[model samples]
Target: MTSFGRISIMACLLALLVACGGSGGGDRATGVEPGPTPPGGPVAPPEPDLPQASPTPYAEAEALFPFITAVDIPDDGRPLVDFQLSDAANTAITDLSSADVRFIIARLAPVPEGNLTGNWQSYINRIEQPGVGPGTESRLQATTESNGVFTNNGDGTYRYQFATSITDLPQDILAQANSEGLDLAYQPELTHRVAIQFSNGREPANPDYDWVPASGATENIFRRDIAATPNCNRCHDQLALHGGGRVEINYCVTCHNPGSTDANSGNSVDMKVMIHKIHRGADLPSVQAGGEYVIYGFRDSKHDYSDVNYPQDIRRCVNCHAGTATGADRDDLVLTAQGDNWAQYPSIAACGSCHDDLDFSRHAGGQEDNSRCASCHAEDGRAGSIQDSHRIAFEEAREAFKAEVISVENSSPGEQATVSFRVSNPLTGEDYDLANDPVWQQSNSSLNVRVAWDTRDYHNTGNNADNASSIAANALTSALPRGDGSYSVTMPLPIPDASVGPGIPASGSGVAVIEGHPAVAIDDGGSPASIPVGDAHAFFSIDEPDGLPVPRRQAVEINKCLACHGSLVLHGNNRADNIDNCVSCHNPRNTDRETRSIARTPPTDGKQEETLDFKHIVHGIHAASIREQPLQLVGFRGFTTYVYDEQTVHYPGRLDNCLACHTDDGFSLPLAAGVLATTIDTGDDHRDPRDDTVVTAMSSACSGCHDDAVARAHMSSNGGNFATTQQAVDNGDVVEQCAVCHGEGRSQDVSVVHRVRELP
Candidate 1:
């Protein structure tokens, strides 16, 4: 569903490059000096000397960092535990004193199945509203404040010895648990888990381990890999939560079990239920049925997720709950652990969390027990299987059928372009005569081929120079098929003159695009029939009819877009999944003139027409939430609402990581020297190809997201041009000097500033 928003703009404008500072010249303790001492001032005191202890020397390292390697609680009845820590550093480790780092430990016990979590936190020392059901844990556990102090060996590791022994909980914690009427017995024989959370101020690392005290085993029967941290970082940059308390999912699940609940709202904060409800925020049946999902946290702060609209379809469970690994060789799979919990297991608490409107009270077996729920909800059950229920029609159709563009020919300037393509069942390895397919002949089914010129940049001079022809299924069937399972259709290049020898269209390359969906009975009794027609594009040249044509630059790929947004069926399903197909109409010169036509919808929208320049539109739309002046762009026939939903927009990852979309460091500065400036909406100009006002290429892209006066002023000072005629830019009179400061290898390089994983 997210066509342009997935590839959001990283606000890497010139001003920000200064914010991602350069190499430091001072030690970690004393920051770089502002200036030399005043020569005329009285000499500063240097007399007092204090006694120093023989400090524990830190082990050699190449860059002090946080990485806990091991955590163990000796089961020999000693009130002691030990954990090892390793770190990275560009220089020998020196600054990591006991004062520079902190550590905490949590002791957990594995419980029986039917319990929401495999393990429960025995380390959480306090509980709130704990009479019955679920209650929140205060988590004021075995920290230095509780006298469960750790001894820093100063050799890049710390061995934390609790004040209480492994044989029992602290007296106070025990008293509190007993007063709360809890059953937290000291079960040393059961699987015991120790989680160590460490931080070095700059970075954090959490390491957890499982062991059976009685057997001295390092593995656990209760371990589960329902989901891992890496899966979350795909969207959340580093996945740190609770101010770094729950740094990893392993640590998070310890307390966010079925035992946890938000007392204020009476809603379960179980990880299984909370995560689903949070992600399905606005779409939660209970929410739509006029209820709010709120969780009162630390200090009783209200966290409302009612406006949390997930960027993709929530039905795509695999987005987060990828099924268990297929290979038997995987370590996590071999364990008797829960991996792929989303699909393999079905729970009333988990399932009902999202589908809250399903009143299981009236159902035959009710919600008390989930033992029999799998009989009908298993992957291969008789009906309402988890996989079947969450099936995406588009993904299914995509797997069953394929639409591919084979080639584009006779693509010279001023000449009509011919396209040869295929429509077939990819699963069966058989081709379908488009004209003969009953699905294609049915209502809401058709194919459209568009031919655009000058692939180097689609301006081809005046505007969005592309011509499209909607071919009826029967019309294609009527055409003679080529010997190779393909059919060809010819359409005008619409380059103002198609026959002028070696004209604009004949220069770089001509892009041929085809897109459309067929009405199928695949979902006959399901919801609306699944209509999926994956679009494709190919470049061709008539200038050298037999030559391997030069194609347009591939900045963004459909596959990359699919990483975050599983599929993009835009504008009534006409524009399928190809990002390249988008540029055909959303070229540098394109705008939303047609949609804003006084004839289309109410209010005549706005005074100006927004430019549909690919990069500008992508940046403007995605970064709209942060801009002082939000972008307004209604699509064809107002396919999508133009009103920027600023209030509800939430970007989950670090905005600086441009690699989420950009390829080959394309997001770096010094863009192609003569790149075309994009037309912007200003002063009521609605020209098809606005000749009056335009924003210089780099300015258009950078300013699209940082659309504020101060940032614009900064961009303006750096040779960024805005609200100028295209001739002013095309005449070589305007040039951007961005690379001087923000290029690939400069001091404040764009790549350096935007890198999410590397040290700044």
Candidate 2:
């Protein structure tokens, strides 16, 4: 787990807000009720007079902008791809001109479970479903001195046959790799494009399609013969729609600016530096001083970001767009734009970790001005520059608390003993304890000392293994009851000596000595600076002279709910499968809307709100489809809006699986978790248990199979779409309340409203 370092002073402010009240109005509309329809019976809205498109690629992208005003991509989704070339105007690119080009494909790095990289790119594999069109293609071909070639074959119409003896490794890439100590082993040339004659050449129809970036300067024709992944469109379509213009579709060019030169140096700005500097906003004083923090393109486009608010301290590039830390693409460091000295321009420490002392202010003969640093580091920061750069700053250490061994002596050598530690949170002031006070969850705040002793290695026979029986033999497990403030743990030490055998040191004690707060920096009085957590340590004993076995102590990290509970895109798969994302959307607003009637109160009340044991809607829909549990779509809204589409319609994102992020080993860590249920409550009564008040349970809105037209209609509509006329009458006009583009009538597409109502 990446160290969040100290809970910078800024995080304290956020914690304060959370304490003052609940997170303010984080919930979105639960339903989309359609407004009154036209005079005639419901008809498809007139085809919008979308911007006319010229043959130019730029014009095409611009034309599509009007329809995608609201940002459809969920928040946790990768940031929108910016395509505007440095020094380029807001205008879109109309040219597709290239001297020579070849199609290239590359498989994205696999996403591991629960990791951010996993969260961002895991959907690629989720696309292997039936009936959906092919997903995105991946492959790379040869490159010229300056031009690289990439290839893409249409779905199911392409082949992947690799001819033996074909020159796979491009000679030039090999040469460059050899000289630079870089690995470019995968670079190759396509022997030939498989025949395009499809056995059944059927024109498959699917709204999901994407442009595979072309490589090489030479012209070539590449056709995909296999089915592509449906999830490909999830991000691509979102990028296009968000951009609102065709000239803006080259999202790959955003962080990977095709040709961007740095402000101060003659070198080009690499992807790593750009992304790092962007995400590390506050840490960079130059950036915090009203720097133009832009990613280029997607501006003035139609994205409904009205609800997409972020924490005040925006994360630096690596925070989200991490590098090798998450096991993502290691070459993510390669700069897209090239300059005389592009290879070693800047790195993470140089760019992402903005320690302003690296600037001229600390250098000799450097005039102490914002320009002092920007002059040499960021050129755009020059006087009258539109684009501003971030400045780095350092924080003077208030105090550093390192963990020290107060005392450690075995009462009976290994039979039983008590460890005592007096740890301190140095940042604490006379008025409060940072951990106990509101600052506990602050960004920079941390437990001064997290010392733990692990005998797992001592008793186990295998490498780094633990002896289950031996562990049970000791009282150490019982002594360390997770959150207990005391540090000393007593248990039976099987071996009298702390040292292990030859390979394994009999000195089997393993402990983590946590000390002063992690080094943390923040936006200064306009200067980028860092402060060190003063003085801390951990002390223990072992049998041998070698280092003792250590048990790593992990600090408590808050779980980000939006990771799996926000936006979802389902194309080839069942769209309604996005229940996980939907829950976050439909869940009631806890911070606002005080309901007088207890029955209307939101279910989320710091309790076990989601009862995973029972699911009525799932049974109702699938059962009725297969002729099992028969129930008519109930309520006015349901009948009009909640039509079920198994293939095309899908849940916005991942389906909520209890195990996806939770690991209940019976240990209750600091994070929120499911409570142990003693009894199975299949109670059908809709009443609040807190009080004897009448309450609407999730069973009504999300579980029951009631055949109510109004309910069905309401459920059918999308959260931000127009509610059907009947739904509007029942739930009120969604237009005025949530639609990003409000209009007098429902001229826009409100099909989502219809979708929710068409339940079985």
Candidate 3:
């Protein structure tokens, strides 16, 4: 008997013994009295010992699933094949019968030109189903029925005896390949794809049921390795489709290989053609030229991807293909088979997949034979190499404009301040005079050389008012050309008088910024390319006895943004790349009113007050998808309005990934005490006649994203107000006591509020 059976018997015997009063005291069946104790007061009854059940075997403790280990096909005349199966632990699974495993073998044959009807490249193993047309010729080659006898080896393996050999394939399949100029008799050249589905009646209880099905094909037989799913998942989260049953790339390639097509749409579904077109989406030359790229699948459902954007430059081949990684050799990019002419060899079909330019053939010396493509497009070749050709020229010359401020002195209200600065090529360590170079002079005309002044006490409070007051030094008027590598400039300061207001200080602290376009250029193998780059600042006191410089708070770092954007260039031609320079212009007092007035579609209220505060704008732009309205910003020079539609500004990843951009715990909470006030334009005449409201720093920053009615109401319930209360006093203007609960180290901090455990 089995151990389980023995345990059951023991249980029944114990119950019967208890019913019969077998404890050596009383006869319960006859109702007899128990024995009496005579010595030392009272006697204690002896305890009965029960039999213990045996432990279960390790193998039987949990259910086991079958896994295909190996497949063997002999060259002998006997038509037979062998398969090996094992458990998860590699233990032999010798108990499964022939009915436990199912197999399908397919020959990867080339589709003939005559058979290239409908979406032939996307055809899978679907054979006749309802509205869908008859599947492609490839499906007919591999039937769903089984025609072999299984012989169990009794040692965890099975041998299947077929009734035919390779030569015994249906005459129709051989005829089709022959029409396509393929020789099926050449066994070594033909690719065979195999699929196996296994079940041991235990899959119902397992969570990973789909994984029980396995599929694989002859590798390196006819195709090149292009993209991997893991790399795609870096942004796609997970590449799942068709109800997610098909997840592995290996399985996808078997059906998505050559000879597959969608009969309903008449489009080729080859991996290269489909993936390129899918990612290119609305950008495809055909789609752009008034053609629709659509695919029909499943129950004749049409999937049109004419509006999908690839997010990044499609020319970045390395972004998807593993073979494009640094230091990869030529063999990594080349196809393995010679017979698969369309893609198995370097051809225009592959190159033009994404480029969509028919003129490439003309550019490649009009050569019909693509064998010489590697001569100029080799991986590590010279100038015309694929890698060198795609290199961005501007990125290669970025260091030429790197500049720094040496010092700033004699900075006082209505006084000419002397500024000294130097510029150099970071790549070559060569110094260049900014005031004399012809290229520098031409571009420097648009450059801004300015100094910003603010109280030292406010700067120490972590406030962003370091640039509260600024004065520009006209390059043509104030700059003195020094023959040396450095240059000097004198500019009049525009600090406000102390008697102007209650919060305004006369001579407590000050800062000066000497920044402008260095106008450096580099030859990009063609014309000279110029980019904006130069920034320098200094801290000092106007009239205080002792002055100590207080550094500004370091929040977001430029390197973090570079991780995704490659290069964070903004404001026409790279002037706003630096964080310090960005904050200088996008401060509290700045607004988009000037540009809004001339906007193509100005606000109907006849008043526009959009704050340019850095914190508020950044949060609003990132969270634009969740906002109820569009995010519109006006340009500083062109008086142009830039509107960021929610659909177009999709963030690549989850917004809760704070560390993806922030450096320190800077996103923690309660903003700096000295942050400047912000004016909010309600755009509704019914709410307020002025339609302009001034809010505190923290309130403006949070409301930028949480502009919902409920959020606004909750904020208003607290001390948060949209309009300024007291204009002159430091913390008394907006009266938003946000630090009471949402302050750093508080119960409900900013981090706690924005903390996202999982993407919803």
Candidate 4:
């Protein structure tokens, strides 16, 4: 059907339903169960003809950002450069009257080739780290409005004249910088950078930077581009930090160099060291060993990172660190201008930042410098080498053994399912036996398969850890037969009586998730240990006569989630490397209804149940730190309570940039038609997705992050409501007028408002 035809049909249906006071506002009197939407819980019916999405280009969205067009320094010997500021379209905004413009002028002290002289920090400790080192650094002077003279030429560009004179500077001040016959003055033959941050009183704050030769020379120009802002924006959306001005990493490294020090914390704020330390924040050995990681910022503001959690494993270097130029030499990229630097570049400062408690005397052979560090730590077959050392644990696990859900048999309506799976050693190219393999014989290890119904959403079946709707059985104990290099386990599936398919709802399928950690002995730093293999999921159709099963929607990319969360291993390795498996348990109908807190993590109020719905929980968990109320839940049959307090968590990205976690236009409003409302107050009854005083589907998700009263009131005023679960399911469901104002192509569309910078 034509797109317009589909939309018109839906529109007519909406009008017809509304005229009859459709299920959207279900008849509260007779409880006849208003019905227009689907009968699912967390997920709505897949919009067969979802509206066409048109994402706004980054530049147009951030129209007021200052894009520098030109830079010049006259032969007048002044330390100032004339620069122009342009709008998003590359045309001049001309007016800088209300803009906050600042500039930075700094010269790079390039490293010489084959020079180990400055490849690493000379930890001037027993006092503090980074006694002195030659690395990229900003100048002592940053152009402030008071110190620098600002000129409005009345053209599209403006100029900032510096108060300091280049020719009048002392030559002997940087004897170390000039040791190699390189002068720090504004020399055209040397590498110099001019950076600026411009923002109008109300427009977006943007940063601009350029690399120019003070004095053009080949040997002394040090520049590294291993990563860019887009790489960071991958997770951070738009990272605005350093007093919310220095957004670009290129502009940041100029100032946060080895030469700079936070006098208060007695720590180096160098990009290489500080960034490493910041990423390994709470995990740093020193921080874990009763010490705190802190950095004193501008005006001596104490920036404490002791409680900060690095989302992914710090050993995953490639996760955040990558570049095209191979670092400035990539070796001196962080330390010295030598080849094979960065991850391969072994430096005490960089390594010691995370392994702070390393016994320097015993390790690296008591080396005080980085000269001999490369000899033993070379990226070879040896284990401790950079590339070898940084390998993720999951990679190691993959080499030992992997589990795959081979097939499902005898899975008919109200029947037991025979699941076939295989565990094989990828390294040896052989299958592991469940009966004889010692790896599978460990008491601490386990193997199980979870059976959940209705791939559309588990709303039809109660897929809990200890429920029939979601049945999980020990595969090892239920092993039926061994044939064709695969093992079979037969387990009963509790199909509901109203099932439309052989055992499931029409258009629905089933999932048999091979979930468990069978111990496979692998090298853990020269010793043997056991690790769980990744979860293997196999989907089968219960309704489709053609045998083609439709799987659930891929909401969030696992790679993106793994990019930040090294391994999505939650609940002590029970669920590993699978978001699909997670949603099976964390569906819309799931909640901590029967939970009674054993840890007193401060029990819930008991008046309301905390939902385990993937949409609501994921949103609430991340936005917990900012939400007006905490995201509190109880689980494990009342033994556990998980509370994401507003005070503890600190989400690093912009909350409104829904693309940070959602896929496609998932976050865009006008939620799917049948996406059922979450049970807000389980009206004097058991907690279920079917019946409860609930927040409507649209309001449910919106309120997850924006949980303020005014926001809910606004939603309620605009056709979004809080009703009984059945009430919402009956009332044509998605009644929110949000899309008209906030949908994909609306004036305040999310695609445009997020201002997501697209990278080519």
TM-score of each: 0.81, 0.26, 0.60, 0.77
- Better model by TM-score: candidate 2 vs candidate 3: 3
Residues 1-760 of candidate 1 have per-residue lDDT tens digits of: 1132322321111111000001011111222211222222322212231113332223333323343333445554433444444444212232343333333333455333244245454444334442322334432222221234445443433444444454566676577656545555656566666654443344555566666655767753545556666656656655655554334777666556654455545676667887888778777888898988776554454667776777677887665545443223343222223545566567678889988888777655575556677777865677666767877766677666677778766655555566788877878998877767777777677676766656666654422222111212232443458877778876633333433322323366667777777777666685345375777778777465567777777676665466555566676666778877777667776666555553234323354566777888677666656788767665546455454445445556555667666677567788864457786552343323333477888888887688889989988898888777667776768777878998877997977766634212
- Which stretches in model 2 have alpha-carbon errors above 4 Å? 1-255, 261-270, 277-292, 298-694, 699-760
Q: Count clashing residue pairs in model 3.
A: 16
- Per-residue CA lDDT of candidate 4, range 1-760, in tens? 0000000000000011101111112221121111222112222212232222342232344455444444445565444444544445554444564125545555555443223223111111111122222323322212222135555544444555544445454444344434423344555544556666543233345454444545433343455544466556655656555434445766665555565455455566666777777667667899889988776443334566766666656676654565332333233123223323555567777778878889777884587666677777775534367767776765567567678998887665555678888878888888877787776788867888877766776654433232223577887777755776788888754444444222323236778888777765455455334466778898887666887766877767676565446566665466677877877767666565545323345465454456667788788877865688877766544545666663345566666666666777667777765566676554443423344666667777878888888988988888787665555556556366877888878898867776643321
lDDT of 2 by residue, 644-729 (tens): 22211222211222222223211122111211111112122211111111112222223233334554445344332211222232
Backbone clash total, candidate 1: 9
Candidate 2 least-lDDT 10 residues: 118-127
Model 3, 66-160: lDDT tens digits are 33333434453223334554444545555554444434444444432212111112111333222443334332212221234555554554555
For every model shown, the clashing-pair count is 9, 164, 16, 26
C-alpha local distance difference test of each model: 0.56, 0.24, 0.47, 0.56
Off by over 4 Å in 1: 1-79, 89-119, 129-147, 163-182, 244-246, 323-337, 379-384, 460-480, 493-495, 498-506, 526-530, 542-546, 599-607, 681-690, 756-760
